[model samples]
Target: MHKSFSLQMGDKTLELGPKPLVMGILNATPDSFSDGGDHNHVADAVAQATRMVEAGADIIDVGGESTRPGANEVGAQVELDRVMPVLDALQEAKIGKPVSIDTYKAVVGHQAIQAGATIINDVWGFQRDPELADVAAHYNTPSILMHWDPNRDTSKDIVSEMKRYFNKSVQIAEDAGLIKGQILLDPGFGFGKNYEENFTLLNRIDEICALGYPVLVGFSRKSSLGKLLGVEPKERVAATGATTLLAYTKGAHIFRVHDVRENYDALQVAHATIYGPPPAKDI
Candidate 1:
């Protein structure tokens, strides 16, 4: 069985377990690999977030910078300018879900938490800016650390390398005062892995979950899916749902995705099939 966690995010308590949780991806940047410029405006982003929540998203992850391979990196000020408004607007709109800031910069993470983001999702797994861990620790928020190292030799066992990378990330978090419950691990689906290595990582993801932290997988609309299905990012919802089911069976605790309702429906069916139907509600 997958491990469960109860994370305290400001006034809210996020429960991750039993059934998988869906974290809707809200990329406020204009250059994300998918959905770029889709929610660049504050009103559009808020509207999309509300739709995701209504569609059963458990969390909303707001990212200002594009971390896609070969995408130009934006500075901290630029990222803050792009993201702060959305964070503020989401809080003001009261989306009723913990908002996660997707960034690898310490400064941006710091200000984002102050701007009302309750979770810190570092794509670089604190390797890019170790100080980001400190920010999460200081705010006492849950942090999702994803394994990413483009320079690593992919010829080696990718799972082993990922574990080693996560070991360092966990140490950084712990050293920065973050406890086990405040941490989540991601396999970094397409970030640093080659085509085969990506599949190998997904196949061996249970090993990462075996490390004792809730595993969050974000294979939604990734290029890997595109390459496999010979489709564009916008057409990969079904493919993304397929990975969601596979990862769910493999003990993954959270799924970060672009398409919320499809994945939510997929998880509901899968959970019901494995664990029996959920308790019915009164009319």
Candidate 2:
């Protein structure tokens, strides 16, 4: 049987698991490390999302703010302006996939859900804004809670720290009335983790996956990969693919990525090679 988790986002139902879910990255900010201002315009954003869907992206993660280390924060209105048009255009175009809002502000989360987004991919893990959990609960939608620390640095033993963070975030989500299956957790690959620490976490991701909620891994073009391959952000596609395979073996069910088609194609081959075709019993 396929491991399944149900996420009710507005009028859509996302059945995630068994097979890996690929979330394509779409940033509307002008300063994101990759594909930032490229998708700021409504037409461009819609086109890019459409292309990702065609490329096998299960979800398109739309973010208005740049979360790369040392990125300057934008106000909620700016974030809203950056994301709303894309959300509107995507829905208007009938993209036939869930649009996850990459945000932490409660107002933006609420507005994004109201504007047709179904998931909140909060990097702060709902700790930055407590109301974020409430927004997810209110919409009966799911939110992606990433692991974080008090100092917000992954310089130490981040695996243990990530477990504790996931525990707390899960409690908060449940307390806010999100059902058991409506919460998703991410290991937050490079959010605060250093080069080695990021790999350590990825290697031991099953520790987080054991928590029961679906695990989302965002290793796309992360600096850790760059540092490992000694390449720049633009050259991390192969590195990202390697990590995607490693993460799946470690029980990651969702992958947040930049190069969707490459990662998707990589996963297809990896899955078939490892698990063989779907059971002949199914046919």
Candidate 3:
């Protein structure tokens, strides 16, 4: 297993796999499903970003559009307008953590990088906008490529599908001149899979992680969790925590989540019990 790896962006390095890195999700859109319209305002967005960072997040994933099911498509300009203020504010305030822009549009991703985002998180796995990969290459920005098939295929084994999906994403990145080390793979928890498929993907996350790329699990308040527990997305913190622990043990290197503090605390205990003590001089 690739137990340890780090992605460098300027002077910052995000170490992975010693324990799962917490990537707090900050959607500055009006329909992000969970925090939709909550942080649409600049001040609210900045404050929430600060709060999540202070609560022990390793990264802040800021999105301008909502990827919730049935969500309407947003233009690049609309997306940019929604997220720029938040990005600018965070940059001005020096949030002290790498900010990842969650966008699949090339123009938006490029602008976000120029505005100070360190990583590009494309939920379409680099397929929706081929230019998105080019943006990453141009900026040499680290990327999180999520496994998303618009078809939502549930007929096959999801883990195998994930491998195929990631393989394609890697090729797309490479074809655009993005290096292997600059790419991270996400299982796309609730993106295209059904309830059973999501859990199955979680249960066999090791196969996905075995791809030798850092594996990021974004199962925070996902619809799959809500459906399984019969709770709403906002009411699924406990369920999210439970999945966080499971994903941690299966070699998930990063968690794209909403409840940062709870996942941080859960991982600390799991890290201690499963991975044992930290290095004598390490935190």
TM-score of each: 0.97, 0.94, 0.95
Native-referenced Cα lDDT, model 1: 0.91
Write the candidate numbers in order of decreasing TM-score.
Answer: 1, 3, 2
lDDT of 1 by residue, 192-276 (tens): 7878777877888888889989999999998888999999999999999999999999999999999999999999999998888
Highest TM-score model number: 1
| Candidate 3, residue 205: how far the Cα is off, in Å | 0.5
Worst 10 residues of 1 by lDDT: 149-158
Query: What is the C-alpha lDDT profile of model 3 across 3-27, one tens digit per residue?
Result: 7887879677878767678999999
Which candidate tops lDDT?
1
The segments of candidate 2 whose C-alpha lies over 4 angstroms from its true place after superposition are: 1-3, 150-156, 278-283
| 1 versus 2: better lDDT goes to | 1
Ranking by lDDT: 1, 3, 2
- After superposition, the stretches of candidate 1 with alpha carbons farther than 4 Å from their true spots are 280-283
Native-to-model Cα distance after best TM-score fit, residue 244 in candidate 3, in Å = 0.8
